[model samples]
Target: MSDRQKGLIDALQLVVPQVELRFCARHMHVNFKQKWSGKSFKDVMWKACRAYIKFVFDEAMKEIKDMDESAFNYLMAVDPSHWSRHAFREATKLDCLLNNMCESFNKIILQAKDIPILTTKYIRRLLMKRFLVKQESISQFEGRLVP
Candidate 1:
């Protein structure tokens, strides 16, 4: 995933052609908001990006078009598959729209990330700590799945 860089897209196509590229919706919204900012635009843009059904996505885009063709055109310039859920490959089973989780992981591993060996140890320790904490919660749960 990226912030919608054309160069990165080109590079990925060359290096990993089979990998699906995605845009951080947060970044797309920031760029879109620079030209057009308002409640309607924000709501519609989010609706379009979050829509898993193409029809719902199209309806949102149509609304944007009706409000302002230029705004619609601006969004259309970038392929929907890069930033919208409707175009995402179902096989991936991951519908992440932003890099928040990635950022959080990076933050947690920041200190040892430079050393590949240490990074694994750090992550293992972190996971063990987490599992230990979760044990108490799991014991309290009555269902097969935690509540």
Candidate 2:
């Protein structure tokens, strides 16, 4: 998943043609709010994102259209497959709506990003700490599944 930069999309398509590109719904909403900002729009936008079936998606989109045709047109200009759940492929078995995993990794090693030594040390410490905590947590588990 990505924030849907055209250059990055082109590069990914060129490099890994088989990759299923998905735009981060959260980021899309941020861009969407620049023009259509309100509770109703926000609610319907989320409804569209959470829709796992075509009928539900269509209904949510219809609501958006009824409220404001221009907003619906703007959203429709981009293919639904890129950002909407109803059109997504299930090959990955992962239905991620945001780029939260990548963002969290970036956040963990944040600040002084240009400084290699500091960044490396921060990441190393954070990873080690996480692993240790996970290990300890697993050790206390009496269940069959470690996850």
Candidate 3:
């Protein structure tokens, strides 16, 4: 494996030790689509990717317990930084794995990149409007859903 791939594996082992090393299925699907163009395949791939992310944590823990006895034993000694689904909790020391926080910032930049130079001002205004709308949507949704 390349240094970059090895580093990712190492990081995963350190952060989420009880999970099997699984590549992000979203990224794998994008790569597969780039290699072979097929809309039908893309749709199915996306469905599988969603399912994988939704359920993989439990499956991974099981696999880790079964496949690597020594590693599993070591991991059991390390406490996971428990993250509650709807509560604000600080990440434990092991939670340094660069995750969606970086991706969300990159996504914002990518979304703004296509703005025409002449229309940059207009694009910024539009972006602000869209952001406010999204903020309000979230506030409303959370207000309804959260206590």
Query: Top TM-score: which candidate number?
Result: 2
Q: For residues 32-105, could you state the per-residue lDDT of candidate 2 as single tens digits? A: 99999999999998898889999999999999999999999989998888888888887878888899998888
Model 1, runs deviating above 4 Å: 109-143
Candidate 1 residue lDDT tens string, 1-147: 887666888899999999999888999999999998999999999999999999999999999999999999999998898889999988888998998876777788788878886778889898798888899778878977656
| TM-score, candidate number 1 | 0.75
Q: Looking at model 1, report the run of 10 residues with the lowest lDDT sum.
A: 138-147
TM-scores of the models, in the order given? 0.75, 0.80, 0.32
Span of ten consecutive residues with least summed lDDT in model 2 = 108-117
Over the stretch 61-110, how does candidate 3's per-residue lDDT look in tens digits? Answer: 44445644543454334322222111112332232222355466457667
How many steric overlaps does candidate 2 have?
A: 0
Q: Could you give the C-alpha RMSD of every candidate to the true structure, in order shown?
A: 3.2, 2.9, 11.6
Question: Any runs in candidate 2 off by more than 4 Å, and if so which?
Answer: 111-140, 145-147
lDDT of 1: 0.90
Question: Candidate 3 has what TM-score?
Answer: 0.32
Which residue pairs come into collision in candidate 1? none
Clashes of each: 0, 0, 0
- In candidate 2, position 145 carries an lDDT of 75
